[model samples]
Target: MATETASREPRTKTRTTASPTVGAAVVKRTRTVAVRLTDAEEAAWIAAALVDGHRQLGAWVRERAVAGYLGKVRPKAGGGGLSPEDAAEVAALRQEMTKWGNNLNQVAKAINSGQVPPVMAEHLEKGWLNRCGQALARMADRLDALDDQG
Candidate 1:
């Protein structure tokens, strides 16, 4: 009778194997990059990252590195690579811009400090406008040169 009752009981099934397709769509990150930094360098990088409001130092470094690379490799507007001559011209233009900026700052300071009479201020304003016009002309010439090269 015990054997009959045991035979009448239901059998239980067990699953011991995992499905092979369970994680098919998931990608594993296997690549890694390693860098050695001095204590001061690490601190400086961490400080900069924090100042930029980045939660992760590695992310900050990666973003900066990618940006720098893109800036160097990106082509100019006229579809030509940046040659040495182009680089020199750019540097000269930057210097000119800095000089003009300083001149404008001085003019503003003089005007604000009441160091110049109204008539003199008018003359200074005209001169500043002329300087700006000249800078624009120079930039136009450079653009023409670039057009010819392209």
Candidate 2:
């Protein structure tokens, strides 16, 4: 009887990701795509990116491109960005503060000119100035909180 030998091939190692989330895989963006934009076009994109609170234009562009390619809407930037309600509140607070600043400046100018503004006198008599101070303090607290979040 003759003996026969079995041939075997070397096995290669395979790698896989052990991600906890099912059906979710992290992909590295390694490819670079150069885009040419005019000054106006770049400005427009930068403005849009700022509105979306994106500090990096390249990251914003990549997100927009991928969203467009997938036919999905680009969501707002999450980290360090305010929600819609908070943004609205901040805008209102800014407008209110502007008005208060203008009133204070007018009062100061009147006082320096050796004349008391009637509105200032009225606010003082009605104790409205105290109320305004309280409001400003509250606004300052809220703004401080918002700044911390950002």
Candidate lDDT scores, in order, read: 0.56, 0.64
The candidate maximizing lDDT is: 2
The sequence of per-residue lDDT tens digits that candidate 1 reaches over residues 117-140 is 687678776785687768867876
**Worst lDDT 10-window in candidate 1:** 1-10
Model 2 ranges with Cα > 4 A deviation = 1-51, 54-80
- Write candidate 2's Cα lDDT for 1-150 as tens digits: 223333353224322342124466754433445676764565556656645677567767767877789976665666537655565556566657777778768877877998887777887689866777887888889978876776
Give candidate 1 misplaced runs (Cα > 4 Å).
1-80, 117-129, 143-150
Q: After superposition, how far is residue 149 of candidate 1 from its true place, in Å?
A: 4.5
Per-model TM values vs. the true structure: 0.36, 0.46
RMSD of each: 23.9, 21.5
How high is the lDDT of residue 100 in model 2?
76
For residue 80, give model 1's deviation from the true position in Å: 6.3
